[model samples]
Target: MSRGHRLALAILLLTAATAPVGTAPVTANAGDGALVTAVPNPTADGDAGEYAVVRVPTASTANWTLDDGERVVAVPTDRPAARVALTATPNATRRLTDVPVVAVPALALSNAGERLRLRRNGAAAAALTYRDAPEGDRLVRTDDGTAWRPLGYQPRDVHRYGPATVTGFVLPDSPSLPVETLRSARRRLLLAGYTLTSSRVVDALIAAHRRGVAVRVLVDAEPVGGRTARGAAALDRLAAAGVDVRALGGPRARFDYHHPKYAVVDDRALVLTENWKPAGVGGRSSRGWGVVVDSAPVAADLAALFRADAGWRDALPWRRFRRGKTFAPGASAEGSYPSRFEPTETTAAGVRVLTAPGNAESALVGVIDGADDRVDVIQPTVGRRDGPLLRATIRAAERGVRVRILVSGAWYVAEENAALVEWLNGLAERRDLPLTARVAEPAGRYEKIHAKGVVADGVVVVGSLNWNENAVSENREVALAVRSDALAAYFRETFVADWQGRGRVGRTTWVVVAGALAALVLAVVVARKTIRFA
Candidate 1:
């Protein structure tokens, strides 16, 4: 009777759909000008866990100050958005609503110079344009210099993805660029109703500010602060360089907002990846690819969720986000990658194939309910309690879904979630279920295989969050779902190599976990054989 785990599913659904769980609401940094507001969550630093709306405000007449006492003024207010550059205070644990701690997401959006025009019903709904947009609420017009465009959107009711399903996404880029990803996320948001933001993003704003890229970031109204908010620093830097920085308003949350990691670059490319901070490109992050899709419906959906220039005057800011005539669409070169992503209109309902942090929970049900053939899961950690997610996996296997899981191999750490590893295996044997499990041994450098993805027939989910329930409900997490095989195969191959204990050697790519010890032994054996032969 592997039914829908009705009680568990219902409880999970109810919990996710439930509004905030009685946390105090505080507005710390309330300011004027064009502001992007995001419901700030508890700082991941394990401090006093406070939540507020980040009121980052930027305008021509604005002067900015950050938590680190960093100040920037008279900066150029034209170009891409930038984070205020501020130094983190030493061991500062008290959460500050107006502490002016901006954020920097993990991976900034990718820009390929190529642009696209997104239209609905013949009239242009949004355009994939980029350029020097000022730090105020405005639009960047087309080359013809005719009409204006508005980049900001109003805030709406926010919902978590689902129980254990992070009803959220990640927006990790600079203010203006990050704004683009927020805009892109709007659609999924409108349809699904969730919140999203990122870390590496705040860094982008800082970089943009330093480079004289006119910057302004609008975060959720809630002002949540962490130890080091690179976004705030970027905002400070941009203000110092004469760029106006601003923030808006949001509802205060009792708990922290942890799941957000997506980026939109110059409103050109929308990037979905898991590399945050050291986890992104040019860092020690695991093997991950950033997919930059061309779509405006995506951007518009995100923009709709933000409280658009609501705090500032309705003046044209620059050449891109300004409310104006649509730019000509770019060439529609076929995407070499695979995508079965159906347009919103064509997608079917009741498949209940929702995507989000909560997906971790849904993955089990997603497979149990729909996986008629197989279910393959890969997570660095799978804890006990037979979480709704794990239970779903076991149930699917029991029902003949060929539930197979590949847990990451902690080549170095002794208790590297090995307990959970043994537990997953036990789950299979205890139930005598036809489930298969494997440990992906490390292939190289002190790098423990950290790819968290799952494959259920045609559905694929990928991101940085672990499979553990803690990640589902606690940590800041983000993941993307793809119904394409091409993408799945790529992920599968990488997983296989790690499990086979074969590091595809390249330059000093990454350090192998204690597997390095194995290399040492191999070298010794070869040396001994040569001496004996000689």
Candidate 2:
């Protein structure tokens, strides 16, 4: 069957209106249990496809249930999943009226208006519901049919706390779903409808704020010496437009926000990228691709990290640096972090935040040395590098780190980098490095890999730009060093697909010779034209 048909089959399986296990009582996450995510309620039945599947954190080995009405289907057992499809019948109100959320010591999710409050016996619990819907479906346990919370009763300033969760998305150029697919991707996200933005994206938060969508953005505040005057102008525009724009510190500070291209919409969809320009660069453009998830725990944790980092609060419109207060972007809910690197400890998971005085390059080297199980790397510009990052990667591959790299760019910037790229390949071929491919082979400039990410042993380092020191040391950088398995696993799968693409760019052909001849003829014609003009 076609891929589209297969995808349809999967959804059909999720919504097949069948009851689950006929056994007696089965338990899930204990206590004032569970936090999750979901889409805004559909305005009517026309909003059917617009629903979001939600999966709360439970046993990795435990099966899940999505009880819309009499239809009970089993959601796959995983750390973060969105397999639960909520079928909203008309007048079937899905609110945060009932759902148990742990205290600040655990995780919580908030709506656009306020924190998600779980009401037990009409009393508000301290832990906010991690996933609460204003429109569509909210939390209702299949075990007891209890609605645990009331909607919009939680405070607006209930700071989000817990260890950082990350969603690592490397925009791959699927031949069928090319870069232009970004427009469709943006449309898909917009169609899902979020309370976080007015338009899906592209207008920045000014438009979102006006739409009553909570608008928050983090931009790199660092100077790129003389390289690209990109971030400054964009942030300026956003700030002037009445958006909540903040600048993370430049290369000089201790906790600067270096990578600034990623923004998570409504904590359900994320755009992780290096091409932060509202447009592309130097005659060449960019291709963007990513996944929209149903897991709110994953979304909430990531959004929390973006807020806690001090780099975002120092500059631009939300210039809180002068106020001397902590850089708390939103009120802390439950699972929140102090920065991208710090862990607030939510779901029994641990996190590590690798600082980048050296920027992404430093982070890359750290990963090479840190991996115990799997190592996956993604790059838009894995350009020429003589430094520690390159050496560390090679060493890790040699030592059995299961090193797999997806270089999105062609390493075509400098002749030197292309040569180095050749050397790295030669080494991998010679068994000097145990590397595999994840992205489609460099498909010229038309399609390139633009994600700079590394995930190892349930840890993820994702951010703006690529796998080159040019970005970390000289350019402005910002990223999250994630410590959640949910985020890390997502990075791993996306990395695998990208690596497969890289593997497909097989042996070079004589097309190079033909291309060279063509270039020579064109150059001659141009030269002759210039002479005639003179």
Model 2 weakest lDDT span, ten residues long:
189-198
TM-score of 1: 0.44
Which regions of candidate 2 fall more than 4 Å away from where they truly are?
1-204, 211-241, 244-258, 264-271, 276-348, 351-355, 358-364, 383-386, 409-417, 429-432, 436-446, 474-476, 483-490, 502-534
TM-score, cand. 2 vs. native: 0.42
> For every model in order, what is the number of clashing pairs?
126, 43
lDDT of 1 by residue, 1-534 (tens): 111121122111001111242221222233321112211112233222221112233443344321111221122223233323111231221233223443322212112111122122222222222222211112222222311112122212222221111111211111133233434332122111012123344444555555654344433222233213333333344345544433332222211233333443333223333433343332243333333334444334333322233233321222222123333222211112212121121121112122232234555455446777767776655665467777788778888878767665555422545555556566666677777566555443224444566667665565555555555543334444545455445445544544455422212212343578678779989888543321
What are the models' TM-scores?
0.44, 0.42
Write down the RMSD of all candidates, one decimal each.
21.3, 21.1
True lDDT of residue 220, candidate 1: 28
Model 2, position 252, has a per-residue lDDT of 20
lDDT (CA) for every model shown? 0.37, 0.40
